[model samples]
Target: MTKKGGSKHLKRLAAPAFWPILKKEYRWVTKPSPGPHPLGRCIPLLILVRDMLKLAENAREAKRIIFDGEVLVDSKVRRNFKLPVGLMDVVSIPRIDVHVRIIPHTIKYLWYVGVPKEEVNLKLVRIENKSLIKGNRLQLNLHDGRNILISREESQKYKTLDGLLIEIPSQKIVQHIPLEVNKLAIVMDGRNAGRIGRIIEIQEKPGMSRRKFLVTLEEASGHRFQTILEYVMVIGDDKPIIKVSEGT
Candidate 1:
């Protein structure tokens, strides 16, 4: 995939089948785990897994934890959340991998966590994305340490990519893609883990065809049922509001 863009970037969207969703909601889904992992804040994954980290151990040990089924995204067990998740990605793991911060060379963006002055825009040699963009506050594990949250800033950072100090500019943090696609947030927590259904219709009035999404949720016990539940607006957000989930 090639195009005339501002900078010579790599990759389009991530591979469609790259992620494997869990069949059922894990019991630890609502345990209030930290979010926006450190790997997500620094840069895109292509740059992380390729270079930058100082890895001197056996390569397979690192690969198994990052690539295997240990990572979860948005309450679902995601095997490959590191492939190329952007601002739209939500990540989590079952039992907090306490060995995260000590992994050596993983840059993290932390919300509820602050960052130092010197660690921004650094490429990740073993992770997926590393160039810390803006609006990316992340919590990360760095080598036998507690999970940490840190933020990155804009500055002129130089790295010897091809033996030359490649001067890179500060990154801006702007999230929200497909900006037109309104989010269907889960209002009722703990029920189906907010993975119930998609919006089917929207109405300026009670009954109208103005619905947005038609969703199919994987209910517990592996049943695929159809319903129009998730939507952008609630029953009283506006006059004669359009409601998705019942009793809204």
Candidate 2:
């Protein structure tokens, strides 16, 4: 048998520094293309299973588990080791009774968090774009690259940046959370990543150089932090719509 000819290794220097791995020791690593998650914000499924989760001893073991239809991402079995899993995405291994969701972290860009059984199918995705299709149907482009189409009338209530709580496998919309003042949000970058708070105020900068709007977040303990609009992801109105717990 012959191996594939394409490059399968990513340069350690070119990889994202925030990734939890020994950067200097390994000269090459897996580089995944744009998939459910963006390139820089996601890690390859192989490294996640082998190195992060310690589920498999090596890449070969990880690939075997995935190919055997034991690894499910977003409720669907994924065999590709290079699949990109990002924030808010759920990972499940029924055989081990283990499930986790990727969440943002201040120190590490993203990290895995344990997800209870009841919350395994729930995921929040932000509306990144909206467009009208040929048959008068409205198309919603999600932050994770998933698309959903509905009637124009049905989509009237949704706007760009709004969050939708969807049930996996079925992809049914269970809740719609709007992006506005007083809504609950989480900082995704720059100083504060996992801090959950309510939106106190939003300031739009029309003529700024590269920065746009700024959002003010007020934590439960009265602490406040300001971040660029793009650095936050709206997750709820009064509180989080799903369960979040740190994994071992």
Candidate 3:
């Protein structure tokens, strides 16, 4: 008889290119469990602990560490070894005092950047979409699987693609960064993925669709390029609130 569910295993060769794993060295790889992010855009917790962070010598060791509640994602203990960690998610190993935030990369699709202890509880999430809900509340859907409900009047201040700096665990909004000219933004995808710059101009199309709009960004090196509004994420106003690049 054939199985009705998806396969539990993932082949090494079928893994994403951005994953820092050897395809030929191993035949099978750990498949990320269904989570906030899709398989192609996330790193499995087992792979993260064993391979990327080198915290464990092998899969068995990694599973032991994760099962012991030593690993925390977004300030909460995540016991699942196959938990999917995606962009802007914070991973912490309190036993060793290690903390890292997943961010966009120029070469690799996503990468982890070391963050200070004070920033461990803070996270930035992009507003993917929003809608009206019961009790005159507006629900904001973030890039992650989190949903924030607010008064409809207050929701008017926020727009899609805007970034919200929130305190994890509590999930309190500390600040809102709007996407507009002169704001610091980062390209999440396309040819300019991971490029950080200032938005110089916003070219809006005649239609009402915001996705068709174009944003021109000027890098610090004086290079400028145009990308779709969908690919741009506003990170800050004058400067980034957290460490985004390495060696900063």
Q: Candidate 3, residues 103-213: lDDT per residue as tens digits?
A: 889998789999999999999899999989879899999998999988978977999989999999888999999888999998887889899999999998786579669
Superposed model 2: Cα runs more than 4 Å off: 1-8, 206-211, 245-248
- In model 2, the clashing pairs are none
Residue 232, candidate 1: Cα error in Å is 18
Best TM-score among the predictions, by candidate number: 3
lDDT by residue (tens digit), candidate 2, 92-161: 9999999989888767778888888998889988888798889979999988888888887888799878
The per-model lDDT (C-alpha) reads 0.27, 0.83, 0.91
Q: Estimate TM-scores for all models.
A: 0.21, 0.91, 0.95
RMSD to the true structure for each prediction, in A, is 21.2, 3.7, 1.4
Comparing 1 and 2 on TM-score, the stronger one: 2
Backbone clash tally (model 2): 0
Residue 64 lDDT (model 2): 94
